[model samples]
Target chain A: MEDQKPTSILVLDDEPIVCKRLKSALEKRGYEVEIFFRSSDAFKRITERNFDIVITDLKMEGLDGMAFLTEVKKRSPATEVIVITGFATMETAKESFQKGVFDFLAKPFKLGEIQDAVERAEKKIKGNIS
Target chain B: MRILVALDTNRYSQYVVNEVAKLAMNTWADVTLLGVESRKPASNGTQPPRNLPIVRKLQEFREEFLGYFKDESVSPYAIKRWGYELVDRGKGLLEEMCVCKGMKDFRVRIRFGQPTKQILTEAVEEQSDLIVVGCSKGEQCTWEQDRNAPEKIVKAAPCSVLVVKEEKKPTKIVCCLDHDSVSQESLELINQMVTLHQTDLALVGLTESEHLREEVDQKMKQILQYYTAQKIKAWVSVVDVSLLDKFIADTAEKGLIALWMGHKSLIGKFFSQDRVGKLVRSAQSSVLILR
Candidate 1:
């Protein structure tokens, strides 16, 4: 199968550095990457149906990663969600997994690890869409 | 992309630094130059001593390696302030060299403990996209008492690990479709790297016997056609098991070799251990074992 278009990725992080780093890395890999520092802005973009994958930081000021993912999945079940949390606990990890999150990574994770998770999630999206 | 480079007292680590500098500049990636020193007892168990002298080995290598590098901006202000020996020097040199190469998002991190453990831990904490580590000549390339640091990191790292034997620009990106499956994961990963590097693609198919040749050839065509549909053209070759080693070495010289990785893979298991360590080390370019 051929994807005529590039994969669209939405990255949400409270930390600007995290968003910028992920944007550059994923952009280099040919994904159209957009970064958002505010959860409200990210939530708006998700409802607009722009991105194929949503990578959100678990801990945020307004909307936390879990609630954000849950809301995204409810409206757009096909959209893949990958949650990254710096303060990962067993309970939160389980909750995200049960919520059908594509993958949950503990913070200070490797960029490669996140990339791999995104690729795996992309396959699921392709399967769902096709 | 978050890229962590592990610099040590070895001269080869300089090559890793240069390679990272050029790569980070081209990719606009965030770079972290990490130097891990052996955990030694602080004479007072409190503050470190001032006026840290440069490690003789690190100094010697820097002079020799930098002699060819025309960048005069590679200074060690942090090292002069931190008051440590070789490792602090490594951290400063790597950061300075990256800055000289026009990289803006670069930082130096120094840790005192087991090098492999600290490097791996940092890769996790920083969420690095890639880990570039340099191994010394022979098997002596280790962190503290940890044996096979290179191989261990290659296996244990959560992200992709690029083991640099010597610094050279990649001419081609090689992807071996030797697995029984359609290689969906491997192909997807390779596609990303290929897009980023814009290097030539060489797909190698391994057939155990003559009867398997037709199937491998057919799969090769399918993969090639898939790429073609995506507007990416690639060359394909079918090889017997006996010629696999030579095939890898020959392909590695161009740029990168992407070998399918798993515990069961003959190729991955071979290169991930000491059995084929020399083969990988001697390759002309960098090695990326996709897991």
Candidate 2:
């Protein structure tokens, strides 16, 4: 028998409230979570270590979410990236899906919605491994 | 925060609901969906029938608004069922209605009278923090019956008002700050708008004279610092008080124009009531009158 490693998630949004709430909610659900308010910092951390899942915002200050997620996929194809944005459009959603994003959620969404997204992502991650 | 959404049976009103839903969900504000019908009640003061076209349309609007929050297992503003009571005040039949209760209030109401007067009265009675309304796009923002309803609400609202023109998304929010008396609530509202649009923030401060540049700069710096701390991409510039009007007109075409006209705000003094109404009608983009 071997000890199992908990699922690790990295959440990035320029809005501190979004980051904080995601971190708290995800942690409560038995997941290890780290949050960043800057895309640059999140990118640096991503380059350092790969996480099981990544949740990001489309619009950010220095480096936008789309570019950051592309780099994440380039490094680790298995890591699922879920995008949550305040300014959502059909074009952005299509582009995100084309880039192989796991899920897309709009801002002002209830906590339950993200949790469901995370659960679905987890199932897909587990399926790929099995 | 309480939000009063004044709607008419038009395409303009249909689009405004989505905008209001975004704001309401973010702020968790108590919301009231108001519909005004330009009809006269009977002389006997009898209540209007429940199946009037306007009432049915209002119910449809309510459903559309609630659709935005449907996926959640436990809704924040939970609604049970539609309920209404007909109360006849002096003016006409005022239907005070609600669809049950939740942590926050979501109500659908109907009024019979003039559009502008009814909307204004609802704002005052609900003690709403903001009013969200829409008008036609182009040179004139005409309602179904009233042509200048949106402009009148912006000019006479006791609280802040958001006039949504076209469904165009703003690339930036240009907040014109003329004084240091901006309220924290107003700033938070601007932050929400910036986040909603995923746009940059441009702060324009007013300077009366060459020597006043330093003072205005200092004030702008303070406000700029606040947004910076919030991790919002923001910048500031000082405009001569004389050129403020021209600056706003130029910027309004591209971004949302947010004017902080609090009670003690100098911007209120600069832009008179008539001027405020004119700005609301003439701006190419949407306008946010922060009171």
Candidate 3:
């Protein structure tokens, strides 16, 4: 029964389609996912509950991905943060690694790409939790 | 096969020489030692002495260097040349020496030039399958300060460059995957490197949302499928944040890890720095970060 506990993931993105698509896709694969449309909402929930992985879009209206990543690390240092963004730059990529982001994803990303990220996260989580 | 150990008469050069000898012993390839003298102007401008004493000392140093390899069965030759201006001349001399020895299968030519360009050009011209270079400690002299040589060689060389900083064997390799779109290429490269080095492969996926597990799974399947098709020997495991420490520990076992990150995934400014630095510093294994 303990082994059957669903891998919990937190998805933070403003886009409804992205969240819904990921949520549905992840749920089908036996993972429990929580979605947040706003960075603040995601931050609040993160403080309230533990997540194995956190995937967030880099660009948002307020409390952008980096800031969200910082808060995530502050609150749940164990949770691995992966940032997804459409605009890719070398400086930002370096910064993500410096900030200890587990991985970086570019926008317009394929479902398979997101899945790959989740798989890596899941592996990390399993190693930690079990 | 012949290997060239570019000797610079420095401590770093000794390590390069030792590693090359070990590799030669393992591969049974002949070794060549090349000593290059750059005629760049001295900052002091006193026409720094090129006295006969200095020449005699260099010759003695060369002989002493060759003495280290005397016990080994490898046929060794030494050549000394002066100045970047005479690079073509030096190469010609090396070519003549190789022909004279009647050893055509493999030849190692070690010479000092602008370390990066000379190595790359000679590797291509010599059709070397592998180029091994020692990382400079940079403490004693500023000669090898540019660690960028490895990166530059990777970009330009026709063959693979084995950049050796310390004597270490890779036990774990981290393959950074974005999706199946580029996974095949990434996996193929990873598989070749792992098999060549006899190392384990760790698959790392970065997700933007928690709900992307299915997508990630499918991609992993694709990667594994390709590896299976190729019949490459590797241990594949998926890692997420929760199990990162365990993954790190498992990878740290051999104290050497290679991280394969596709350049495409490096898109955008927000996530770049953190991603690069995290993998660079945290892992216990020596990192081979591939672009």
Reference-based lDDT, residue B234, model 1:
91
Question: Which prediction has the highest lDDT against the true structure?
Answer: 2
* Per-candidate fnat, comma-separated: 0.04, 0.02, 0.00
**lDDT at residue B100 of model 3 (Cα atoms):** 34
In what order do the candidates fall by lDDT, top score first? 2, 1, 3
In candidate 3 the C-alpha lDDT for residue B121 amounts to: 70
In angstroms, how far off is A83's CA in candidate 2? 24
Q: What count of clashes does model 1 give? A: 12
Q: Write candidate 1's Cα lDDT for B163-205 as tens digits.
A: 7767766777876655544533345445546654666788877
Candidate 2 or 1, higher TM-score: 2
- Per-residue lDDT tens digits of candidate 3, residues A59-95? 6767888888888888888888878654334355456
Q: Give the C-alpha miss distance for residue B165 in model 1, angstroms.
A: 1.5
Question: How much is A115 displaced in model 1, in angstroms?
Answer: 13
Give the lDDT of residue B252 in candidate 2.
75
DockQ of 3: 0.01
TM-score of each: 0.52, 0.61, 0.40
DockQ, computed on Cα atoms, for candidate 2: 0.04
Query: lDDT per residue, candidate 1, A29-124, as tens digits?
Result: 899899999899999888888578999987677888888999889887777888876544445655776787766665444567678878878877
lDDT tens digits, residues A1-130, model 2?
1127788999999878778988999999999999999898999999899999999998787899999989999999999998887655545655776788877665545576678779878877887887
lDDT of 3 by residue, B43-150 (tens): 354344354332344455455545544633223232212223322343345222222331112232334447667776776555454455544432222235333454
Which prediction has more favorable DockQ, 1 or 2?
A: 1
CAPRI tier for the interface of model 3: incorrect
